[model samples]
Target: MSRPPTVWLTRASMLLVLLAIMLVSGPARAHEFRPALLRLTELADASGQGGGRFDLRLVAPALSTAGAIGEGDLTPIVPAHCELGQLRLDCGSQGLIGELGVAGLDRHPVDVIVELRFVDGTQVTAVLGPDQPTMTLDGTSDGTSGGADNDGVFADYVALGIEHILLGPDHLLFVFGLVLLVRAAGRNTRTLLWTVTAFTLAHSITLAAATLELVHVPGPPVEAGIALSILLLARELACGQTDETARDSPLLSVNESTKVSASGREALARAENSWSWRYPWVVAFGFGLLHGFGFAGALSEVGLPQGQIPLALLGFNVGVELGQLGVVALLLVLLAGGRALAGAVGLSEKTARLATRAPIWAMGGLAFAWTLDRVLGFWG
Candidate 1:
């Protein structure tokens, strides 16, 4: 037997309310991997003995006065051979070379981007993590940075990109909404491919453009727009109700050998008439541009490696695509398993339909909450 409509609505409402509360109350930037910046510039000495003033500044984004981001002090570890002065390290004739590390990083696990500029115009940039707190400053002028080589830059960015997508609940929800939209429209695999491809291409363009400074948009508005996009998709999914009474419609004669139900024909006609159903790729592509801006905002937080922007950009974009596809695959598998289990348990069609629609409601509720919070954040 099917569940009462009132019960289904009540359960869905409760779930939506809970999700909204959690999303609205939680720290917005809690999961974001905002990197701290560490810059060191070697000062010129009259004797050219490689001893000069060192400007050590650790800049990291923070929200509250609690946690490692707020309380930890970052001090640069200087070479033992050099005399550590108040602002400069004196290495009388050593040329400012040796092991370099940042103190106070052990207290936190944030990635710190290190930039070393020598008097001879040699510049080296590397990413320092808690696991590997120290780097050997070889004091070389070669293109390779002493700590992070080209390969390391690529890999670090790839990992960062993957981590960003996985940690971003909003982006995942948008993709999930896309999947629901495709399934509701009864789209084939080819259509799904087009939809995903369009989204990827559109976002990649904007991400590159925004990162390269070719395009600039306010981050808060972009965030709100991304949430709005998900809400729009949810609306479309909710509107796609199948009609089972139009049995004799000629729309079913496309295949005479196969049985065509009234509901199937009605669905096809609805799909044909609906712009979202017929051209989902267009919708995805348009919204993807807005989402790309959101991605650029995150990328901007973790400054790009100097002289390797292209490589880092490529790696990050590739990582994002990998993470996105993984989410889609995992969701597909979970949905399949859920359907199989429902069938095994002999669930009523109405109950199953309610379960399917619950996620859509959750997505809409969460997206709405996120949009409202981000928009109000503009004032804050």
Candidate 2:
């Protein structure tokens, strides 16, 4: 069935606007995997004295398969036991490796997440990234106390949380989608403001809950959901036409032989304006809950400081919002500059109207493709 001309033009406009965003974001890097993870678990020693032997597992993939994250090779760390076909390098009963690095130890060191799980059900997770490639597990700490500074625990998690959101482009892209949903377009600052707030509040709720173990959702499922959320917003963009109510709204108007008459156009204008005001908040809050779980999932993979769970959780949420706000500010600046440049060029009103919507279309396309791939990846 042919879409109404209004719908088609609207989608076309959105696609062009987001085309730049997709290009800048590099469409090839959707849900890119993080550096290698080196997890160390301590089994319970007999007599309950603690200090059990550690088991280490490193999972890295060089390539992704459909929805699954591909692992990188570990031959550099242990050429004797590591094989090209192996997805995981296990230390077996040998305990923690004396030294660990990625394929190119000298040239390119990567992060190894060391998770020291104790018999007492506590965990101490620390990253051994390029700056700190090798780690020595001091079994003496008993895995129950603060290995890092107690007062700085919150600060550390906040930094990690910020790093996670910024580095996790998928989450940031979702925020980008939210901005498009209620950005400064046509002076929708109020709608954008409330919508962004709602997103913050909602995600904070879930991030706190999930991180605290008040609720639990697995990594893959949460990831799939985040992708779907973006997909839904994209579909919304495709179906939504420009706000004819706004004089400068890039969406086509009724007089241009749209699918509607003048009256219908007015009706659409009101609906669209209202939709912009309302939909972003509703969508942000709803999808934000899922996104929070997604945050917890990422934090889990990297591991959290057991002694400072509350601080870590809170810090991570704050970090994510800071990253989100930073991106939003950048987007607003770019948007203003783009508008200025567009006006300076004296682009036709028609061109400007449609041009603004291009980004929405691009965002939708990326989200849809990601949703499809991630959903299919559950089989892995």
RMSD of each: 5.3, 7.2
Off by over 4 Å in 1: 1-13, 16-20, 23-26, 29-31, 45-52, 63-68, 73-78, 81-96, 102-107, 140-147, 241-272
The residue-by-residue lDDT of candidate 2 on 244-313, one tens digit each, is: 4233332322234334446536655554666543576887898889887776665555556666677766
- Tens digits of per-residue lDDT for model 1 on 5-85? 758665876777676659553555323556677766777667773465555555664521235465456677777787775
Off by over 4 Å in 2: 1-53, 59-110, 117-125, 135-147, 184-194, 212-224, 238-264, 267-276, 378-380
**Candidate No. with top lDDT:** 1
Q: How many backbone clashes does candidate 2 have?
A: 19
How far in Å is the alpha carbon of 182 misplaced in model 1?
2.0
Best by TM-score: 1
Model 2 is weakest, by summed lDDT over 10 consecutive residues, at 245-254
